[model samples]
Target: MSDASPVHFIAHFTVTDGDGYHNYEKRFFPVLKPYGAKFITFDDNVTVLEGEREAGRTVIIQFPSEKVLMEWWNSPEYRELAAIRHQATTTFSVSVIHAIPQR
Candidate 1:
């Protein structure tokens, strides 16, 4: 995939330590700003319409491009905050999906 392609960061997790996760959330937006990340949505009550996938807290974020997203993902600030999230959540899963090219 090209760096110009837009991407979405989708995450699902169950918060085991609310306080730690909350701390991560509070600090997330500021670090995300420089990368042109757009907050799509977050849902604590996700209903699985199909499949047997277990749904927990769901977060969706859109980045202008994969290049920008990777910069943010690999940044030190985000890494520090992510450590907190790792300790707080269980069944954690994250997926980076690229948007299809314009027809």
Candidate 2:
């Protein structure tokens, strides 16, 4: 993995039911840890500097590699938890970004 950069999981969520979403949030961390995922940030105060502004909460998570990211995303544990998120909120977008190498 030395030759490759880390991968980031970026998600934008529009929560419909606070209680349901909260339940999903509570269980998120524990499930993610086993897969070597690190929570970067969850931002509710998002600003659009360019074309259009999107509404929702933004969350960023990092994985050691894209392979790890895919493993975590496809794992049974995460899939179960993801069902909770699916019911709780409307996901605007979920993307995997490869970090740029540092100078």
Stretches off by above 4 angstroms in model 1 are none
Question: For residues 1-98, what per-residue lDDT tens digits would candidate 1 score against the true structure?
Answer: 56787799999888889898889889989999999989999998777787776657889999999889989999999988888888988756788899
Given candidate 2, what's the lDDT at residue 1? 37
Q: CA lDDT of each candidate?
A: 0.87, 0.87
What lDDT score is found at residue 99 in candidate 2? 75
Question: Which ten contiguous residues of candidate 1 have the minimum total lDDT?
Answer: 47-56
TM-score of each candidate structure, all chains considered together: 0.89, 0.88
Measured on C-alpha atoms, candidate 2 has an lDDT of 0.87
